[model samples]
Target: MDGLTGLLDGARARGAFLLRSVLDPPFALRIEDRAPLTVVALVRGAAWVVPDDGEPARLDLGDVAVLRGPDAYTVADDPATPPQVVIHPGQRCTTLRGEPLTSTPGLGVRTWGTGPDGSTVMLTGTYQLPGELSRRLLTALPALLVVTGDDWRSPLVPLLAEEMSRDAPGQEAVLDRLLDLLLIAALRTWFARPGTAPAWYAAAGDPVVGPALRLLQEDPARPWTVAALAAEVGVSRAALARRFTELVGEPPMTFLTGWRLTLAADLLREPDATVGAVARRVGYGSPFALSAAFRRVHGVSPSEHRIGAATGD
Candidate 1:
């Protein structure tokens, strides 16, 4: 656990702070998000986002919206009309008077942060590094969390403020990690408190299903059978099947099959491998069988995936 904990310790990512504006009615966070996701807790006013293939959603103060993937969206006041974009990161510090990523009804303060070189506004001062309890508490948290409103001036608030400032040696790394933990803690609290959607974060502390999930994710290609899995994990097959379906919204076997094929498709994209080789690696007996399943799952054949990968699609 220590080695794995330290694995992502040196994982450096860039942080940015830009305040600019664009004239266009439809505005958005144009720049690609960092490898690490961006967490924004709007301090003032409101924001709205139109996700691709989804309905427009409004965000209020104390609301934290996250985009885990790179998809262009229109964040606006009205869904019918485009909103002006301003204060986008790209336009900030650029020579040209670039259009803002999002329109600002008025000048607002947004604290944008990344690895280093990112500006973090500290409203309060002081941070507390508790012992093993803190680490355990952090690990028990959900993936995303938002703490908002007047009551934010709690003890954690001052600690967060101090963590934002460069006051101690190695503090940058320490504070960054602390912030990550704090965010996780806040999110965990949110999930347990309810009104949250059912997402991956909901799997945190599920007694029966969580262990099974860890197994599947850690070894997607395992020759997992309902009986084998149940026996290994010290549960009856019926119980494992019921619990998996309840938490994951899919049966154990179904999830395993999809995960195996996903890995197989990835291997098929490798320049060195033939379709036949990828099939064997993913538990398929032959190229024809793999192709049938691939086409059924992905619409495209393995060959097409290879072609797309080679052509930079």
Candidate 2:
């Protein structure tokens, strides 16, 4: 798989929180939910996404906004609207004074809002915990990215809205996949726009470094060297190294090591996986070697990381 695809593939949603929010004008929501990532598609009417640290951006009908979070932001009918609702972590809803609002009658399946016929309708999908691999993709994004409706065309948003209210068996799994598709489609369109794509994303089109990056990502378990990678991609070691570093902003081997260790960190989270097993899987020769490298990169041993993860520290 290519680098961009691999990065997004890791973001497969598990029990993602999806909702259709119906609201009237003169409404605002202070979203301090601190979710790792959120995608908001305006199904009707318009709204403004005001990030705490960035300029406010408006979302028109059919426009989708992707927000990178754990930070607070506000969504409202207008930039000047005061927040009436505060959405807390875990998708809990409350008034500005903290009275519970979840008990407010639902408009329909997987839908909630101030009223059934509110003027503005929006679909929200939150990736509550984006795993280690997806974090790589998320890190490259700005705090708020909006794919204008006029610039990109897709049927996924309407399909997602249609499927969201269903209650059939395996419905959640279906929604998860749909959410992934929507995100990928939106990102592909966003990255294709001039001057918006990140460096790594743009480098994926390079003849030499592009293939080299794919090789590294495709089989990170392979014990790869600069010369070996160059040979595989049909370039001289010096040429590949210079070009890869220039485009990717890191030496090839350094990037590979980081990739391997990242894979190792994720593998270590598996309940049945042993440190030695994860080491071999990520290209390390032994647990001790992996431990040293992990410590150097993450400032924690694999065991400590696992313990902290388990304890939620």
Candidate 3:
């Protein structure tokens, strides 16, 4: 798989938190949900996203903003507006003093806000993704990034907006899939802009290195050496090493070890998965060897990771 696709593969939304917020003027919320990733798309009127550590950005109609979190931020009619509500973990909304804010009522399915006819209409999708694979891509994002509707054109905003209000069998699953697609589309456009994409993502397009990367990702279990990879891609071993490092910012084997361990780490999250089986699947000959490498990189053994994953640590 290509770099972008592989990174996004780890971010698929399943039973994601979806909300359609309808707000009138003079509304602001201090968001501290600690969700790993969030997407906000404006369908009508406008809003401002104020990051705690960065400049505020305005989202006009059809605009989308991605917020990488754990850090707090604000969304409001104006950047200077004081937040009346605080969104804590579990999406619990309360007053600034922590008392539950119960004045606003739900408008409809998956919809909540101040009023039903509020001028500012926006759709929000929050992904509380688990596993190291998700963080692998999220770490590349800035605290906040905005994609203007004018620059990148996609019908997902409207489509997702339409889907948000539907109430039917398996509607949650449908919304999750739509949210995932919207996120993927927005990220693709955002990363395609000049110099915005991560180095690894940018390198995925290199004619020489791209094939090698595909080979590695496609069959990470293979006992791949630098010379074998170079030969498969029709390049000298030294040339492949130099170019792969130059483009992907790491030597091939270093990257492979990381990929294998990332896969192993995620696989360990499965309750039925054994350490030895996971080790073999990711190219390690034995559980002991895989545990050694995993500990060196992640500072934890596979069993420890599995326990932490199970307990949501």
| Model 1 whole-model lDDT (C-alpha atoms) | 0.48
The local lDDT score (0 to 100) that residue 146 gets in candidate 2 is 97
For each candidate, what TM-score against the reference? Answer: 0.48, 0.90, 0.91
Ten contiguous residues with the weakest lDDT in model 1: 124-133
lDDT by residue (91-197, candidate 2, tens digit) is: 89989889998734767789987798899999999987645225467666889999999978899999999999799999999999998889889988888887777
How do the residues 1-313 of candidate 3 rate in per-residue lDDT, one tens digit apiece? 5678777776667688898999999999899988878999999999999999999999999899999877899999999999999998888889999999653555888887879999999999997655423656676688888899887889899998888889889998899889988888888889889888877678888989989988987788899999999999999999999999999999999999988988787778766999999998989998999999999998988898888755446
Q: Which pairs of residues collide in model 2?
A: none
Which residue pairs collide in model 3, if any? Answer: none
Q: Please estimate how well model 3 matches the true structure, expressed as its whole-model Cα lDDT.
A: 0.86
Model 1, 139: alpha-carbon shift in Å?
24
Error of 3 at 199 (Å): 1.5
lDDT per residue (tens digit) for residues 112-193 in model 1: 3222221222221112111111222233333333454432333443454445534467655665555455444444445455
What would you estimate as the lDDT of candidate 2? 0.86
Q: Which parts of model 2 are misplaced by more than 4 Å?
A: 269-271, 303-313
